[model samples]
Target: MRTFRLYGGFLGAAEVMTKPVGLTAAWWQVLGAVLREPLPVSGIAREMSLTRQSVQRIADLLVERGLAEYLPNPAHKRAKLLRPTGEGYSAVRRLTAAQHAFTNRVSSRVDVDELRTTLAVMERLIAALDEEGL
Candidate 1:
């Protein structure tokens, strides 16, 4: 569909900007969520609407690569809290800076209010799709 194409194009542009740091879209999403709040693997999975197993695998890789760490979760007997290491923080900062620069460049040519309205519409569409289990 036309909307899918538009979404794909937007994702492609984001990939081009973020791939240099070896961060896939999924990885970035997981990392960004973790950065906002240190969470157990189950918490991250629930927040991101992903499987816990999948998130654990990625978290394991991040830990092994020294980008993230697993610390004992005091609130849970078996869960481990996931937190970003210094390297992960640095990567996030770089990725966000690049994204901001790209957005600023594009926004300079467009009316900011129009851009915001378009984003609101797109977000509504995404929420609808999510509600329908798309």
Candidate 2:
């Protein structure tokens, strides 16, 4: 479908666009997910509409690479929260800067109304998908 093509294209673009931050697309996404508030891997998976196993794997990798750390959770004994490390913060900041620059460049050549319309359409599509279930 055309929409799937669009999705693939966006992912490809994101992979290239995020390289300057010194991380792969998934790494940048996983890092960004925790930059504000630390949460358990399950929480990240829930929020991102991703699988728990995948997020757990990425979380472990992040810890292994020193980009994130597991913190004690007062509410739960076993599910420790994943928080961004100082290095994680730095990488996220760099990625954010790069994204802003790229957005500025692209926004200049794109129609804002068209973008808004696309967002509306995508939101509707997501709602439909949710209603239908995977």
Candidate 3:
């Protein structure tokens, strides 16, 4: 229950943080996923644990807004890779300072060791769930 509440809080924070950049939390999430490398909407959906159709809709909106662009995928002809445009990258980058400050403030209130242990436990839980196909 605490974890669920924490997740909701984080999403709310993300929405607030992204609003000034003209993005919603969902758009920020999808854009952040492809910052390192381009991927198809299905790929993003899989990584983000969202439906392909939902991701497709968001991807289309991003492209339409000139925040992202589609590129040819050498591996899959039909599945175009979605890459962030200059404006997209800039928008995400703009969040960096606020994100860093937020993290710093949060970390300051938590014990480092406790945080590490909690993170480790969370990772283990994720791994266990993945292994179980849950």
Candidate 4:
């Protein structure tokens, strides 16, 4: 309940934050997943907990818009790695700035200790769920 609400609110915020860069929340998510390193659509889907088909669709759109590109994967010939182009990097950087400001503003109203505790609990919950395959 609370967790779902928080996720919904975060998604809404992401949508607004990504709009200036001509990206939707889903597009930003796909781009962000590969920002650190290129990954196949399957890898992105696993990391994001989204369906592979959905990630594939977003990846295609990003490539079509010139925000990202596909590169050969030595590990898997058919599963080419997806990476962001220079323009994509620029957009992500802008989003990083905005996210930092947003975080700072939100943090100002919350107790640091409470935030830390909540994060720890959430991490534990996630780990438990993963272990249980729930």
Q: Which candidate's TM-score is highest?
A: 3
**lDDT scores of the candidates, listed in order:** 0.85, 0.85, 0.93, 0.93
Per-residue CA lDDT of candidate 3, range 3-119, in tens?
899999889888888888999889999999899999999999988878999999999999999999999999999999999999999999999887788789878999999999989
- Checking candidate 3 for backbone clashes, the offending pairs are none
Task: List the candidates ranked by TM-score, beginning with the highest.
Answer: 3, 4, 2, 1
Runs with alpha carbons beyond 4 Å of true place in candidate 1: 122-134
- Pick out the ten consecutive residues of candidate 4 with the lowest summed lDDT: 125-134
Could you say which candidate leads in lDDT? 4
TM-score of each: 0.76, 0.84, 0.94, 0.94
Candidate 2 local Cα displacement, residue 54, angstroms: 0.7
lDDT ranking from best candidate downward: 4, 3, 2, 1
Candidate 2 global lDDT: 0.85
lDDT of 4 by residue, 14-92 (tens): 9889998799999999999999999999999988878999999999999999999999999999999999999999988
- Model 2: how far residue 110 lies from native, Å: 3.1
How many pairs of residues in model 1 come into backbone collision?
Answer: 0
lDDT score, candidate 4, position 61: 98
